[model samples]
Target chain A: MSQRPYNFAAGPAVLPEDVLRQVAAEMLDWHGSGMSVMEMSHRGKEFISIADTAQRDLRELLRVPDNFRTLFMQGGGLGENAFVPLNLSRGGKVDVVLTGSWSRKSAGEARRYADVHVAADAADSGRIPEHWDLRPDAAYVHVCTNETIDGLEFHELPVVPNDVPLVIDCSSHVLSRPIDWSRVGLAFAGAQKNLGPAGLTLVFVRDDLLGHALDICPAAFNYETVAKADSMFNTPPTFAIYVAGLVFQWLKRFEYQGLKGLAAIEQRNIDKAKLLYGAIDASSLYVNRVHPSCRSRMNVPFFLKDERLNDGFLAEAKAAGLLQLKGHKSVGGMRASIYNAMSMEGVQALVAFLKDFEARHG
Target chain B: MSQRPYNFAAGPAVLPEDVLRQVAAEMLDWHGSGMSVMEMSHRGKEFISIADTAQRDLRELLRVPDNFRTLFMQGGGLGENAFVPLNLSRGGKVDVVLTGSWSRKSAGEARRYADVHVAADAADSGRIPEHWDLRPDAAYVHVCTNETIDGLEFHELPVVPNDVPLVIDCSSHVLSRPIDWSRVGLAFAGAQKNLGPAGLTLVFVRDDLLGHALDICPAAFNYETVAKADSMFNTPPTFAIYVAGLVFQWLKRFEYQGLKGLAAIEQRNIDKAKLLYGAIDASSLYVNRVHPSCRSRMNVPFFLKDERLNDGFLAEAKAAGLLQLKGHKSVGGMRASIYNAMSMEGVQALVAFLKDFEARHG
Candidate 1:
């Protein structure tokens, strides 16, 4: 067997090896259904069961509130930038916490249908803003719980007026920790990061948030329509959903340090983040610019103190079987996205490499 | 090995077994990259190469001209309904040829963004209408080349004004035949049907049609935006693209009935359609409502002369390893969607079962 390289892609990111192997085993025929999950019609009974099981497993893994209806959607985080405003804004005022690039793009896209008001901006700091001007009558407040590019994460969700739904894009850090459903009215995450694949976006919308979409909202994307149809309104990314279901099941069985599932995964994520950040802080050759108070647990962005080592570091990392560590183009530094699928051993290997490289370069 | 059942699902339909096997084989590690294709970043070299090769192969298979930019999009055919007008209509009059269920939905959805003029309606005949009320000032003319539910197909594309771009929703029959690039402006198909899976959409838009998206268009779905970004405006459904690239490779090497590649697939489709249609035509127990002149080659909706036998027919078909032969709820009859992946032998099996069932029940 070939050695499995540790993948650090932001997303479509690494999936659990066990989940991938299980998916491969069931690829030709899903549970003796005589059809691959990909081949079954969205409306067919076989696919319906697969979807139902997936939705159920996902709900269990996330401990999604009973009031929150999980809709399997498309268009990713970027598409949802436009989709969120179109569906929830109702051509009204939308308050945005411009934490980083993701929220900034969300606010920019929201301007198409609504009057976008940046309640606070943290572009320079690459952290969640300390201040926010809340508009109670505003349609919703958009936030990025974890900024994939800026490597900033909100340790705690911001408090907004009860009237305004908190639409959080947790694309990068979803599933790494349990979301506080009590504070969030709608939380959407593209599955690529922590869930499953690129094509499927998971929207956990509070039941009350449905049906407020403006007339222009595409019916297929309308939260009300999608929730009512159970996300089968249009063919709901069947294969992605199937793979995600496997990941969810794998998550349910996940255990580490005597903890289980979400708790277990969250603990592991914390450890991985600490170990990597500890290395960076201990090193004279590397630095992470984000405020440690809101540093992302899933995405660790670090730079060589000597900028000239960037290419050499990347090349050597690739040679050492660490892949996709190149940071987003918006940020020139390196970013290692250690999602749930990324095991602790992988991060340890990366840390070892980082130390070895620093020893030689420093 | 368990018998490979014949799946006739409308979309999210059957895939080539060989492609499925190849995908399964590479499920754990893609070409020793030590990561599944689903885990690779869309912008990464590995996934980018996969997307590019898929685009190139599809272009070659369809004989798509140089001027057309092949975009991998999301939101499916329904999403494209809104995406189309939002991008191409510019809030102007958009002419539509309403052939059946699919086109009706298209025209209705377009009315939100444009003054949709139903240039042609074939609801009564279940075939292409003769006269078209094409307006020269219209942004583009919309048509569903194959109406999946209505079992109607346009034998010939209408000769609209040179100023009007002909946008086709060829979701169900895209790769089944050669497209006349001279007559098309933009063609979009959700990959669920003839291609690999759901959640991925193939958009072939001419270069001249770029940059006219309305302010309301989501940058992710905007033709100009997506075209410029090589469909990486969002993650662009990485897994779906990899599977589709495999399908394209399968199509490139396909040989049967003294033909090769697209020619071979088209010939097989022609033969399959004829065999099934002939069986229905000659049968006393079954009836195909579609007009013979424009019956769909990909989806054939047939009814039992005795409607009471519908349940029995579906049950027997399922028992005989013919799955998902049930018609769409909108059309209360059996629909046999013999897509590109449906072999000639599969159609023959269906025909054989049809005759045997008729002898038993009729």
Candidate 2:
């Protein structure tokens, strides 16, 4: 209840306080059952309820049609990069749109399983690519909807060949906005960012794409087997799934400006991004290099005009109770990841810190 | 803690009170960082120390050999059943020794990738198979050391073909005893039981068995790729790994009677099993069906003599704060999973409840 620091960690980022409190209260005993949620059997009736409702809520939230199956899996986004190619690619040509670090990594890992081709690369712009070369007969086209490191995002998905499926790694920005399911054949994200915690990966895949896995696909990692078993083909990450179920419930009740559910959260995210990006654009001392049109709403990476004050800026930010504002080591600067849980108030406080820091050191 | 419930839910079962207390205390901020451990990046120096120390302590406790690489992965036990075949089986013949439910499941899942052979099965004796019929040319031999559902176990591993490696799913009883590294090619366990939580799988594989994954293996599940990147090839289940690390630290400092570390824990486990099994044997109202030699030291499944009284028994058990005593649906009865976190007092409490319930029923 005391003043807590505002966190801006990119991937394993800040979670909603309500979710944390709920977890704490349920740690000793869940729902008067005299056992923690962690202790329940995945197959038991109690846990079955948890799993059933989580899947149902997620389906409703995503407005997923009857043809798509959602699976709660393990391994993070990086794991899915190869997992995606292994299941969808048959050692055939696969087109990859390299938006930033994550998409590039995905293409590199996929090379072991498929003939990978980078249809687009935005390395020069340090942003999401605006143009993509279409490969009509490719197995699938891959994209990272939001890249945590480069601060690039594909607001509008690219049009790919009709024969090719589209795979999106939406790890950093999942649940923050509406996804265009028509443009995506398979989408996967780690749960650490906007969902409950680490360890759980949510995979949304079309029915037709399920059985195309290469002969060597691990049954557990195969989208077909997993979808058939409802993600219970394996002993699931039970506790993480249970927590995520609770989060879906929380999202169902979330409200903002007369809009409820995911829509409300999406609006809040948009507003938060606008406030922070507006401040950065207004300041001569701070600059975000990515094109304004394709900037990530979830992650905003920027640098001070003078790089010498980077250490000082971080130290002062920490002292002011603004935590984990440092950007990735690969890309030096500051990153403010305003996830679903990050309040407008948190962003406001961050903007104030940025201004104060600039006044002191500019 | 005022006589809390005796929790015996298998895996994600019971956690040490000390660990729970420490987690609660650190929920707001870890050390002076003003950020939850969950909020820290896996790449951060703070979390690197946590991940490194956990791996180090676990190695020291288990005395893992230099030739083996320990990787912290995601996906629960069942997921690994497929992941194992994907990484090590290479679609060749896989020999399986089915002691109980878990091994049977493993063999069934492996059939999707390999020409699976039942090397041994113990359904007749309600125990672990005594003699394993290993294939000299088998790609790998799989075993589940502890069967949580059936209360069966293979306390001592078998001598297998030298050319064929042994892969053990030690999910229910890992770290309870010293592992014979010379015989084990790969040992994997889900963290929910003796480790920490669900969603994390600990895989200790010999370096030599690293790179022969099937072309269909999901890149993330490939042991060679995971090892090359030190398990950070993707964003790992960071929070679970951190908690598992804390458990390793606790085990290192543990002492019992003149014994220390794993030796001490094993002795305690043996004593707890003896005490409870003895009570069950002496009582007319309750009975354990497992063969005496293979009865698990961790999970003990027993049935009430009067089948009609099962519901009454469970209701009373919950009322008495002996919780989650219901057996798995596959096998109808009661199961007591006294994992490493369960104390001697907890076992005594459960035993006392059993006696009281029997006396009333009689």
Candidate 3:
């Protein structure tokens, strides 16, 4: 393995080194097209083939139902906060379950286009709320499957009535495991985390939810328009999509333990999260406050019990080739987001560093 | 120079070879930071520095005034069609000067948010209209300075009254020449063409125009929100901005015929456009329909008199390492987009091929 630092940025986070190598190797010319993927017109057959393969591979990996239309789009998760309501809300009531900062933002943005009701509020609980007061008349129910900042995730989705489709902002934990698409009306993810690079947003919308965008929704963001054009409605972030396609290929070929592909990645993620959280729990100098039942398998936010050592811990971690361990300013201390790209070895290194630091500081 | 094919894609177009090489070399480790540019956190000092330097270099290159806040955003030109009105229109009357397809789309999208009036229609005219029906009470006057598909351009912007801000969609020709900022209020470009890549949209909005978004505007696309947050209100496309920053640096270091930077690029663009148009005008087999005075200096669309040879022309050109010469589907012919990245030699090669093909078939 390469000796590069293990980057722990929450999103726009680590990508597999092998994916980066492949991207570098192919930067000058993608395949034999004699043009960089960035240079290819989005409408060209070469790019179309790339787009199709990526969609197909992703569908196969997730076992997405045939009724869902995968739309490659721009405008990260924040953009979709409004887009979901604009497309699905029909200018009616939207029931939002406020799990953390992300879902709070979603409800806030959705209020501009629809009547928003917080079906459940768990922003401070550090765990998923056990029950939601969903309304049958609601246009949709909005949830954030993984809160990148709070380090909380939904291990199982909240049950909504069949008539009221569920919408998820799964930016951080997408592709780490399989999604339960049967209950999902739409799932949107910003590709900066586990998927690939920044700038691309993936939206999987069931066919039934296609054409009801509010007049205020931009055509580029109108789900039906994007679906019809196969996300070429507005250039669709060509380079980002190409890099993401490469990532899907990487995920497809991934093998670990006794499993393969998404199954393998899920197992690895579970192992890495367990190792890091276990170390934090056992250490005197470190702490993680989230409920174990819902603690994120991707983002593991921890703090130094002695808050004064925060800077020293980050400095020491950087010196040891661990990068971006500082926590989000909103919820402070330190965050080590071990996305699908983070290896067990990388996690082990972090655990070792944690123990050594605790021994010295304690 | 590398022996790569001359790419003639319109937007998501050709990028400087040196920039691509730098991107490739720095893919695994960015400036010894031990992380790919893609992996760096947007808030991290490493990426913030990259973003800052890029903004500074772009400001310097364009000589952007202090009153204008340059924002790095997403959702391409099509997205900006709605964003322009949503942010600037204030749900009032919007007067649009329809130059071609892009401006027409802009007008159509603006109508969704504002009471739109076609102040000038030049969609069928091969040149810019000499006059427009000015609406003094309008929120803004919209114009597409260069129509990428129609091969039409405004050598000078229409004289909108001082009170009304003029919004220009300059996606195709931005960065190829200096903007006369004094004649404009806001200038927006999808960075797929002369800038760097797709997914990153550049908006230069005057400070006075900041806080006037419609109530329904998504916060992610709200100009005031974006400006106040310095385009970090949401995760601005980090990788695209990094690449564009490199392109900006490349432009700063550019030299041609004793000219430097933007001046050098402008001169080269002028020369490249001249070479390609000159070739078509001199040929009996191909003809350019747009008026010479208002012809685009970026996209030069031409038609084969004997249309049967279109297939042969494209095939032979591709065989000779000239790529994406086929015109846009909306306008069926051939187009050579000689943006800032296209070298004089590339144009010269295309001209030579043009003559050789005509000599045998004329």
Which candidate tops DockQ?
3
Stronger candidate by DockQ (1 vs 2): 1
Q: Could you say which candidate leads in lDDT?
A: 3
Name the docking class for model 3: high
Tens digits of per-residue lDDT for model 3 on A242-303? 88998999999999987999999999999999999999999888899899999999999998
Deviating ranges (above 4 Å) for candidate 3? none
DockQ of each: 0.87, 0.54, 0.90
Better of 2 and 3 by lDDT: 3
Q: Please, what are the lDDT tens digits per residue for candidate 1 over residues B99-181?
A: 89899999989988899888878867766888888898999999999999988987777667766899999999999999998
**Which digits, one per residue and each the tens of the lDDT, describe model 1 over residues A179-268?**
888889889899998889889999988988787898888877888998888898888899999889989889999999999999999999
**Residue pairs with backbone overlap in model 2:** A216-B216, A217-B216
Predictions in order: chain A TM-score: 0.98, 0.97, 0.99
**Model 3, global lDDT:** 0.92
Clashing pairs in 1: none
Give the winner by TM-score: 3
Greater lDDT among 1 and 3 belongs to 3
Clashes of 3: 1
